[model samples]
Target: MIELTRDADVAMITLRRPERRNALDIEHCDALREAVEGATADGVRAMVVTGEGTSFCAGADLDGVYGEAFRESLYAALRATLDTPVPVIAAVNGPAIGAGTQLAIACDLRIASDTAVFGVPTARNGLAVDVWTMRRLVELAGGAAARRIMLSGELFDAGQARHYGLCDRAGDVVAAEEWATELASLAPLALAYNKLVLNSPDAGVEDDRLSAAFDACWASSDIEEARAARQEKRAPLFRGR
Candidate 1:
Protein backbone atom coordinates (compact mmCIF):
# COMPACT_ATOMS: atom_id res chain seq x y z
CA MET A 1 0.00 0.00 0.00
CA ILE A 2 1.04 3.60 -0.61
CA GLU A 3 -0.10 6.76 1.15
CA LEU A 4 0.25 10.01 -0.78
CA THR A 5 0.19 13.42 0.84
CA ARG A 6 1.41 16.94 0.15
CA ASP A 7 3.02 19.63 2.26
CA ALA A 8 2.91 22.74 0.12
CA ASP A 9 5.10 21.87 -2.91
CA VAL A 10 6.62 18.71 -1.44
CA ALA A 11 4.86 15.42 -2.08
CA MET A 12 5.22 12.62 0.47
CA ILE A 13 4.81 8.94 -0.46
CA THR A 14 4.74 6.49 2.46
CA LEU A 15 4.80 2.74 2.08
CA ARG A 16 1.99 1.70 4.47
CA ARG A 17 2.09 -2.10 4.65
CA PRO A 18 4.03 -2.40 7.88
CA GLU A 19 2.91 -5.92 8.73
CA ARG A 20 4.88 -7.14 5.73
CA ARG A 21 7.60 -4.56 6.34
CA ASN A 22 6.26 -2.68 3.31
CA ALA A 23 7.43 -5.42 0.99
CA LEU A 24 6.65 -4.97 -2.67
CA ASP A 25 3.80 -7.10 -3.94
CA ILE A 26 2.59 -6.72 -7.54
CA GLU A 27 -0.35 -4.54 -6.47
CA HIS A 28 1.80 -2.49 -4.13
CA CYS A 29 4.36 -1.84 -6.86
CA ASP A 30 1.63 -0.76 -9.27
CA ALA A 31 0.18 1.54 -6.64
CA LEU A 32 3.60 3.10 -6.06
CA ARG A 33 4.08 3.81 -9.76
CA GLU A 34 0.62 5.32 -10.00
CA ALA A 35 1.18 7.48 -6.94
CA VAL A 36 4.47 8.84 -8.31
CA GLU A 37 3.01 9.54 -11.73
CA GLY A 38 -0.04 11.23 -10.27
CA ALA A 39 2.02 13.36 -7.94
CA THR A 40 4.37 14.49 -10.69
CA ALA A 41 1.42 15.31 -12.93
CA ASP A 42 -0.06 17.40 -10.14
CA GLY A 43 3.04 19.64 -10.36
CA VAL A 44 4.75 18.89 -7.05
CA ARG A 45 8.14 20.56 -6.99
CA ALA A 46 9.81 17.89 -4.84
CA MET A 47 9.03 14.45 -3.39
CA VAL A 48 10.01 12.41 -0.33
CA VAL A 49 9.45 8.64 -0.12
CA THR A 50 9.53 6.68 3.16
CA GLY A 51 7.84 3.72 4.76
CA GLU A 52 5.50 3.39 7.74
CA GLY A 53 6.64 1.55 10.90
CA THR A 54 10.12 0.19 11.54
CA SER A 55 11.16 -0.81 8.08
CA PHE A 56 11.50 1.34 5.01
CA CYS A 57 10.90 -1.71 2.77
CA ALA A 58 11.94 -5.33 3.28
CA GLY A 59 12.25 -5.94 -0.45
CA ALA A 60 9.77 -7.95 -2.57
CA ASP A 61 7.15 -10.14 -0.98
CA LEU A 62 8.43 -13.73 -0.95
CA ASP A 63 5.18 -15.09 -2.35
CA GLY A 64 5.50 -12.98 -5.51
CA VAL A 65 9.27 -12.51 -5.71
CA TYR A 66 9.77 -15.12 -8.42
CA GLY A 67 6.92 -13.92 -10.59
CA GLU A 68 7.70 -11.94 -13.74
CA ALA A 69 4.73 -9.67 -13.10
CA PHE A 70 6.09 -8.59 -9.73
CA ARG A 71 9.54 -7.87 -11.14
CA GLU A 72 8.09 -5.82 -13.97
CA SER A 73 5.90 -3.79 -11.65
CA LEU A 74 8.69 -3.25 -9.17
CA TYR A 75 11.14 -2.04 -11.81
CA ALA A 76 8.43 0.18 -13.30
CA ALA A 77 7.90 1.85 -9.95
CA LEU A 78 11.66 2.49 -9.65
CA ARG A 79 11.79 3.89 -13.16
CA ALA A 80 8.89 6.24 -12.48
CA THR A 81 10.82 7.75 -9.61
CA LEU A 82 13.95 8.06 -11.76
CA ASP A 83 12.04 9.78 -14.56
CA THR A 84 10.17 12.27 -12.43
CA PRO A 85 10.96 15.87 -13.44
CA VAL A 86 11.34 17.08 -9.88
CA PRO A 87 13.89 15.75 -7.39
CA VAL A 88 13.03 12.68 -5.28
CA ILE A 89 14.39 12.05 -1.79
CA ALA A 90 14.37 8.71 -0.02
CA ALA A 91 13.71 8.93 3.72
CA VAL A 92 15.04 5.58 4.82
CA ASN A 93 13.49 5.09 8.25
CA GLY A 94 14.73 1.51 8.65
CA PRO A 95 16.08 -1.47 6.77
CA ALA A 96 16.21 -1.23 2.94
CA ILE A 97 17.19 -4.57 1.55
CA GLY A 98 17.22 -6.08 -2.01
CA ALA A 99 14.64 -4.21 -4.10
CA GLY A 100 14.39 -1.70 -1.27
CA THR A 101 17.98 -0.67 -1.98
CA GLN A 102 17.12 -0.43 -5.65
CA LEU A 103 14.28 1.98 -4.87
CA ALA A 104 16.51 4.20 -2.73
CA ILE A 105 19.23 4.40 -5.39
CA ALA A 106 16.63 5.42 -7.95
CA CYS A 107 15.88 8.56 -5.97
CA ASP A 108 17.91 11.74 -6.49
CA LEU A 109 18.89 11.90 -2.79
CA ARG A 110 18.75 9.63 0.25
CA ILE A 111 18.31 10.72 3.86
CA ALA A 112 18.50 7.76 6.20
CA SER A 113 17.42 7.62 9.82
CA ASP A 114 20.03 6.57 12.39
CA THR A 115 18.25 3.24 12.65
CA ALA A 116 18.31 2.56 8.89
CA VAL A 117 20.25 -0.28 7.33
CA PHE A 118 20.99 -0.86 3.63
CA GLY A 119 22.04 -3.88 1.58
CA VAL A 120 21.64 -5.86 -1.61
CA PRO A 121 22.07 -9.43 -0.41
CA THR A 122 20.71 -11.14 -3.50
CA ALA A 123 24.04 -12.84 -4.04
CA ARG A 124 23.62 -14.72 -0.79
CA ASN A 125 20.19 -15.88 -1.90
CA GLY A 126 21.57 -17.11 -5.26
CA LEU A 127 19.80 -14.20 -6.92
CA ALA A 128 21.00 -11.45 -9.19
CA VAL A 129 19.93 -7.89 -9.88
CA ASP A 130 19.89 -6.37 -13.34
CA VAL A 131 23.06 -4.76 -14.72
CA TRP A 132 21.54 -1.30 -14.36
CA THR A 133 20.92 -1.77 -10.65
CA MET A 134 24.44 -3.02 -10.06
CA ARG A 135 25.91 -0.10 -11.93
CA ARG A 136 23.74 2.35 -10.00
CA LEU A 137 25.03 0.97 -6.71
CA VAL A 138 28.59 1.31 -7.89
CA GLU A 139 27.96 4.83 -9.10
CA LEU A 140 26.49 5.96 -5.81
CA ALA A 141 28.83 4.25 -3.39
CA GLY A 142 31.88 3.39 -5.52
CA GLY A 143 33.01 -0.04 -6.69
CA ALA A 144 34.71 -1.14 -3.46
CA ALA A 145 31.72 -0.27 -1.29
CA ALA A 146 29.33 -1.82 -3.77
CA ARG A 147 31.37 -5.01 -3.71
CA ARG A 148 31.42 -4.98 0.09
CA ILE A 149 27.65 -4.81 0.13
CA MET A 150 26.76 -7.14 -2.74
CA LEU A 151 29.60 -9.63 -2.78
CA SER A 152 29.72 -10.05 0.96
CA GLY A 153 25.97 -9.74 1.29
CA GLU A 154 26.46 -7.55 4.30
CA LEU A 155 24.07 -4.96 5.68
CA PHE A 156 25.54 -1.52 6.28
CA ASP A 157 24.21 0.99 8.81
CA ALA A 158 23.21 4.59 8.19
CA GLY A 159 26.56 6.01 9.23
CA GLN A 160 28.38 3.66 6.89
CA ALA A 161 25.88 4.48 4.15
CA ARG A 162 26.72 8.17 4.46
CA HIS A 163 30.45 7.56 4.59
CA TYR A 164 30.26 5.44 1.45
CA GLY A 165 28.00 7.99 -0.28
CA LEU A 166 25.04 5.60 -0.52
CA CYS A 167 23.02 8.08 1.51
CA ASP A 168 23.45 11.86 1.44
CA ARG A 169 22.60 12.33 5.10
CA ALA A 170 21.70 10.44 8.28
CA GLY A 171 18.48 11.71 9.79
CA ASP A 172 14.72 11.12 9.89
CA VAL A 173 11.78 12.08 7.66
CA VAL A 174 11.79 15.60 9.15
CA ALA A 175 15.36 16.17 7.99
CA ALA A 176 14.43 14.79 4.60
CA GLU A 177 11.47 17.19 4.46
CA GLU A 178 13.72 20.12 5.27
CA TRP A 179 16.00 19.21 2.35
CA ALA A 180 13.02 18.71 0.03
CA THR A 181 11.55 22.08 0.99
CA GLU A 182 14.85 23.75 0.18
CA LEU A 183 15.00 22.00 -3.18
CA ALA A 184 11.39 23.03 -3.92
CA SER A 185 12.39 26.67 -3.50
CA LEU A 186 15.11 26.45 -6.14
CA ALA A 187 14.78 26.83 -9.93
CA PRO A 188 12.77 23.92 -11.29
CA LEU A 189 14.03 24.08 -14.87
CA ALA A 190 17.67 24.12 -13.78
CA LEU A 191 17.12 21.33 -11.28
CA ALA A 192 15.39 19.16 -13.88
CA TYR A 193 18.19 19.72 -16.37
CA ASN A 194 20.82 18.95 -13.76
CA LYS A 195 19.06 15.75 -12.77
CA LEU A 196 18.71 14.72 -16.41
CA VAL A 197 22.38 15.28 -17.03
CA LEU A 198 23.47 13.50 -13.87
CA ASN A 199 21.33 10.45 -14.60
CA SER A 200 22.27 10.14 -18.26
CA PRO A 201 24.30 7.06 -19.16
CA ASP A 202 26.33 9.06 -21.66
CA ALA A 203 26.76 12.04 -19.37
CA GLY A 204 30.41 12.39 -20.32
CA VAL A 205 29.58 12.49 -24.02
CA GLU A 206 28.93 15.76 -25.77
CA ASP A 207 25.54 15.39 -27.42
CA ASP A 208 22.88 17.64 -28.90
CA ARG A 209 20.32 16.62 -26.26
CA LEU A 210 22.69 17.56 -23.47
CA SER A 211 23.56 20.80 -25.22
CA ALA A 212 19.90 21.72 -25.56
CA ALA A 213 19.24 21.13 -21.90
CA PHE A 214 22.24 23.25 -20.92
CA ASP A 215 21.07 26.02 -23.23
CA ALA A 216 17.54 25.89 -21.93
CA CYS A 217 18.69 26.36 -18.33
CA TRP A 218 20.73 29.41 -19.24
CA ALA A 219 17.85 30.84 -21.26
CA SER A 220 15.21 30.23 -18.58
CA SER A 221 13.39 33.16 -16.97
CA ASP A 222 14.59 31.85 -13.62
CA ILE A 223 18.14 32.89 -14.52
CA GLU A 224 17.00 36.48 -14.95
CA GLU A 225 14.99 36.30 -11.72
CA ALA A 226 18.09 35.06 -9.89
CA ARG A 227 20.12 38.00 -11.16
CA ALA A 228 17.38 40.49 -10.26
CA ALA A 229 17.05 38.97 -6.80
CA ARG A 230 20.80 39.33 -6.24
CA GLN A 231 20.57 43.01 -7.18
CA GLU A 232 17.57 43.57 -4.87
CA LYS A 233 19.05 41.53 -1.97
CA ARG A 234 15.98 39.25 -1.81
CA ALA A 235 15.11 35.66 -2.62
CA PRO A 236 14.11 34.92 -6.20
CA LEU A 237 10.65 33.53 -6.89
CA PHE A 238 11.19 30.89 -9.53
CA ARG A 239 8.14 30.10 -11.71
CA GLY A 240 9.81 27.12 -13.47
CA ARG A 241 9.55 28.88 -16.81
Candidate 2:
Protein backbone atom coordinates (compact mmCIF):
# COMPACT_ATOMS: atom_id res chain seq x y z
CA MET A 1 0.00 0.00 0.00
CA ILE A 2 3.03 2.18 0.47
CA GLU A 3 5.59 2.59 -2.30
CA LEU A 4 8.90 4.40 -1.79
CA THR A 5 11.15 5.65 -4.57
CA ARG A 6 14.38 7.60 -4.35
CA ASP A 7 16.01 9.95 -6.83
CA ALA A 8 19.34 10.97 -5.37
CA ASP A 9 18.59 12.83 -2.13
CA VAL A 10 14.85 13.06 -2.69
CA ALA A 11 12.44 10.22 -1.92
CA MET A 12 8.77 9.87 -2.77
CA ILE A 13 6.25 7.68 -0.99
CA THR A 14 3.13 6.83 -2.96
CA LEU A 15 0.02 5.30 -1.53
CA ARG A 16 -0.49 2.59 -4.14
CA ARG A 17 -3.95 1.23 -3.41
CA PRO A 18 -5.79 2.86 -6.25
CA GLU A 19 -8.49 0.22 -6.19
CA ARG A 20 -9.33 1.33 -2.68
CA ARG A 21 -8.76 4.98 -3.39
CA ASN A 22 -5.72 4.67 -1.10
CA ALA A 23 -7.81 4.13 1.98
CA LEU A 24 -5.59 3.13 4.89
CA ASP A 25 -5.70 0.06 7.12
CA ILE A 26 -3.53 -1.42 9.84
CA GLU A 27 -1.15 -3.13 7.45
CA HIS A 28 -1.06 -0.15 5.13
CA CYS A 29 -0.32 2.21 8.02
CA ASP A 30 2.50 -0.02 9.26
CA ALA A 31 3.87 -0.17 5.74
CA LEU A 32 3.72 3.62 5.53
CA ARG A 33 5.90 3.96 8.63
CA GLU A 34 8.31 1.42 7.20
CA ALA A 35 8.47 3.39 3.96
CA VAL A 36 9.45 6.54 5.84
CA GLU A 37 12.11 4.66 7.81
CA GLY A 38 13.43 3.07 4.65
CA ALA A 39 13.64 6.41 2.84
CA THR A 40 15.37 8.08 5.78
CA ALA A 41 17.79 5.19 6.16
CA ASP A 42 18.65 5.53 2.49
CA GLY A 43 20.05 9.01 3.35
CA VAL A 44 17.42 11.05 1.57
CA ARG A 45 17.43 14.79 2.30
CA ALA A 46 13.74 15.20 1.45
CA MET A 47 10.60 13.12 0.99
CA VAL A 48 7.16 13.46 -0.60
CA VAL A 49 3.88 11.57 -0.26
CA THR A 50 1.16 11.37 -2.92
CA GLY A 51 -1.58 8.89 -3.60
CA GLU A 52 -1.74 6.60 -6.65
CA GLY A 53 -5.20 7.47 -7.92
CA THR A 54 -7.80 10.23 -8.07
CA SER A 55 -8.03 10.34 -4.30
CA PHE A 56 -5.12 11.16 -2.09
CA CYS A 57 -6.69 8.99 0.63
CA ALA A 58 -10.36 8.33 1.14
CA GLY A 59 -9.92 7.68 4.84
CA ALA A 60 -9.35 4.66 7.10
CA ASP A 61 -10.79 1.39 5.82
CA LEU A 62 -14.05 0.75 7.58
CA ASP A 63 -13.45 -2.99 8.00
CA GLY A 64 -11.29 -2.65 11.11
CA VAL A 65 -11.73 0.99 12.04
CA TYR A 66 -13.06 0.31 15.53
CA GLY A 67 -10.14 -1.66 16.89
CA GLU A 68 -7.23 -0.54 19.05
CA ALA A 69 -4.65 -2.18 16.79
CA PHE A 70 -5.77 -0.08 13.85
CA ARG A 71 -5.59 3.05 15.96
CA GLU A 72 -2.03 2.24 17.05
CA SER A 73 -0.88 1.60 13.50
CA LEU A 74 -2.55 4.76 12.23
CA TYR A 75 -0.90 6.91 14.89
CA ALA A 76 2.45 5.22 14.28
CA ALA A 77 2.23 5.97 10.58
CA LEU A 78 1.30 9.60 11.25
CA ARG A 79 4.06 9.93 13.87
CA ALA A 80 6.71 8.56 11.54
CA THR A 81 5.65 10.90 8.76
CA LEU A 82 5.89 13.96 11.03
CA ASP A 83 9.00 12.80 12.90
CA THR A 84 11.00 11.94 9.78
CA PRO A 85 14.58 13.19 9.88
CA VAL A 86 14.23 15.18 6.67
CA PRO A 87 11.44 17.35 5.32
CA VAL A 88 8.28 15.75 3.92
CA ILE A 89 5.74 17.33 1.62
CA ALA A 90 2.24 16.13 0.89
CA ALA A 91 1.18 16.32 -2.74
CA VAL A 92 -2.54 16.18 -2.29
CA ASN A 93 -4.14 15.26 -5.60
CA GLY A 94 -7.76 14.73 -4.57
CA PRO A 95 -10.06 14.34 -1.63
CA ALA A 96 -8.27 13.97 1.74
CA ILE A 97 -10.89 13.01 4.28
CA GLY A 98 -10.64 11.92 7.93
CA ALA A 99 -7.37 10.02 8.35
CA GLY A 100 -6.46 11.43 4.97
CA THR A 101 -6.40 14.92 6.42
CA GLN A 102 -4.42 13.61 9.36
CA LEU A 103 -1.83 12.16 7.00
CA ALA A 104 -1.52 15.38 5.03
CA ILE A 105 -1.18 17.53 8.13
CA ALA A 106 1.49 15.16 9.38
CA CYS A 107 3.85 16.40 6.68
CA ASP A 108 6.00 19.52 6.89
CA LEU A 109 4.35 21.15 3.87
CA ARG A 110 1.45 20.51 1.51
CA ILE A 111 0.95 21.23 -2.19
CA ALA A 112 -2.52 20.59 -3.51
CA SER A 113 -3.80 20.05 -7.01
CA ASP A 114 -6.99 21.64 -8.34
CA THR A 115 -8.87 18.44 -7.50
CA ALA A 116 -7.58 18.43 -3.96
CA VAL A 117 -10.00 18.89 -1.06
CA PHE A 118 -9.57 18.32 2.69
CA GLY A 119 -12.07 17.42 5.37
CA VAL A 120 -12.11 15.99 8.87
CA PRO A 121 -15.60 14.63 9.56
CA THR A 122 -14.67 13.07 12.88
CA ALA A 123 -17.54 14.79 14.64
CA ARG A 124 -20.10 13.26 12.29
CA ASN A 125 -18.49 9.83 12.47
CA GLY A 126 -17.92 9.74 16.22
CA LEU A 127 -14.23 8.84 15.85
CA ALA A 128 -11.62 11.15 17.34
CA VAL A 129 -8.18 11.89 15.97
CA ASP A 130 -5.06 11.87 18.11
CA VAL A 131 -4.00 14.98 19.98
CA TRP A 132 -0.89 15.34 17.88
CA THR A 133 -3.02 15.44 14.74
CA MET A 134 -5.27 18.02 16.33
CA ARG A 135 -2.33 20.22 17.30
CA ARG A 136 -0.81 20.03 13.85
CA LEU A 137 -4.17 20.85 12.23
CA VAL A 138 -4.49 23.96 14.34
CA GLU A 139 -0.89 24.88 13.66
CA LEU A 140 -1.15 24.66 9.89
CA ALA A 141 -4.80 25.53 9.23
CA GLY A 142 -5.22 28.08 12.05
CA GLY A 143 -7.51 27.96 15.09
CA ALA A 144 -10.78 29.17 13.53
CA ALA A 145 -10.52 26.96 10.47
CA ALA A 146 -9.57 23.99 12.60
CA ARG A 147 -12.65 24.54 14.73
CA ARG A 148 -14.85 24.63 11.63
CA ILE A 149 -13.31 21.44 10.31
CA MET A 150 -13.46 19.58 13.62
CA LEU A 151 -16.71 21.01 14.93
CA SER A 152 -18.80 21.98 11.88
CA GLY A 153 -17.31 19.34 9.51
CA GLU A 154 -16.55 21.68 6.61
CA LEU A 155 -14.53 20.73 3.56
CA PHE A 156 -11.90 23.00 2.08
CA ASP A 157 -10.79 22.95 -1.54
CA ALA A 158 -7.23 23.42 -2.70
CA GLY A 159 -7.62 27.18 -3.14
CA GLN A 160 -9.33 27.52 0.21
CA ALA A 161 -6.69 25.34 1.82
CA ARG A 162 -3.94 27.56 0.48
CA HIS A 163 -5.80 30.63 1.67
CA TYR A 164 -6.20 29.13 5.14
CA GLY A 165 -2.51 28.14 5.29
CA LEU A 166 -3.18 24.39 5.17
CA CYS A 167 -1.66 24.19 1.73
CA ASP A 168 1.65 25.92 1.05
CA ARG A 169 1.14 25.97 -2.72
CA ALA A 170 -1.43 25.10 -5.35
CA GLY A 171 0.26 22.39 -7.33
CA ASP A 172 0.52 18.67 -8.00
CA VAL A 173 3.04 15.85 -7.37
CA VAL A 174 5.45 17.02 -10.07
CA ALA A 175 5.59 20.46 -8.54
CA ALA A 176 6.00 18.96 -5.11
CA GLU A 177 8.97 16.88 -6.30
CA GLU A 178 10.53 19.99 -7.73
CA TRP A 179 10.23 21.65 -4.34
CA ALA A 180 11.64 18.58 -2.61
CA THR A 181 14.60 18.40 -4.99
CA GLU A 182 15.35 22.06 -4.35
CA LEU A 183 15.04 21.55 -0.62
CA ALA A 184 17.46 18.62 -0.88
CA SER A 185 20.12 20.92 -2.30
CA LEU A 186 20.15 23.14 0.78
CA ALA A 187 22.25 22.51 3.89
CA PRO A 188 21.02 19.19 5.30
CA LEU A 189 21.90 19.77 8.95
CA ALA A 190 20.34 23.22 8.94
CA LEU A 191 17.11 21.91 7.45
CA ALA A 192 16.97 19.03 9.89
CA TYR A 193 17.50 21.33 12.88
CA ASN A 194 14.79 23.73 11.73
CA LYS A 195 12.33 20.87 11.14
CA LEU A 196 13.18 19.30 14.48
CA VAL A 197 12.47 22.48 16.40
CA LEU A 198 9.28 23.20 14.48
CA ASN A 199 7.95 19.67 14.88
CA SER A 200 9.16 19.21 18.45
CA PRO A 201 6.58 17.63 20.76
CA ASP A 202 6.45 20.48 23.26
CA ALA A 203 6.29 23.32 20.72
CA GLY A 204 2.52 24.07 20.51
CA VAL A 205 1.00 21.75 23.05
CA GLU A 206 -1.85 22.55 25.40
CA ASP A 207 -1.77 21.93 29.15
CA ASP A 208 -2.12 18.39 30.53
CA ARG A 209 -5.80 18.96 31.28
CA LEU A 210 -6.72 18.66 27.58
CA SER A 211 -5.03 15.24 27.49
CA ALA A 212 -7.83 13.73 29.55
CA ALA A 213 -10.44 15.21 27.25
CA PHE A 214 -8.76 13.72 24.19
CA ASP A 215 -8.62 10.30 25.77
CA ALA A 216 -12.26 10.55 26.73
CA CYS A 217 -13.28 11.25 23.14
CA TRP A 218 -11.78 7.98 22.00
CA ALA A 219 -13.37 5.96 24.78
CA SER A 220 -16.76 7.59 24.76
CA SER A 221 -20.22 6.10 24.18
CA ASP A 222 -20.38 8.05 20.96
CA ILE A 223 -17.65 5.82 19.51
CA GLU A 224 -19.82 2.77 20.11
CA GLU A 225 -22.77 4.57 18.58
CA ALA A 226 -20.67 5.35 15.58
CA ARG A 227 -19.75 1.71 15.08
CA ALA A 228 -23.32 0.56 15.35
CA ALA A 229 -24.43 3.27 12.98
CA ARG A 230 -21.85 2.22 10.41
CA GLN A 231 -22.79 -1.43 10.63
CA GLU A 232 -26.41 -0.46 10.09
CA LYS A 233 -25.62 1.97 7.31
CA ARG A 234 -27.03 4.96 9.09
CA ALA A 235 -25.82 8.33 10.21
CA PRO A 236 -24.14 8.39 13.62
CA LEU A 237 -25.92 9.94 16.58
CA PHE A 238 -23.23 11.59 18.61
CA ARG A 239 -24.27 12.94 21.99
CA GLY A 240 -21.19 14.87 23.03
CA ARG A 241 -20.56 13.28 26.39
Compose the digit string of candidate 2's lDDT tens values, residues 63-136. Answer: 88999999999999888887776899999999999999999999999999999999989888898888777778
Candidate closest to the true structure, highest lDDT = 1
CA deviation > 4 Å runs, candidate 1: 203-208
Give the true-structure RMSD of model 2: 17.5
Q: Write the per-residue lDDT of candidate 1 for residues 1-241, one digit (tens) a residue.
A: 7999999999999999999999999999999999999999999999999999999999988887897888899999999999998999999999999989999999999999988999999878877788888899999999999999888998999999999999998789999999999999999988988888888976665777778778888889999999999999999999888
Model 2, residue 211: distance off in Å is 27
TM-score of model number 1: 0.96
Candidate 2: where is the Cα deviation over 4 Å? 201-241
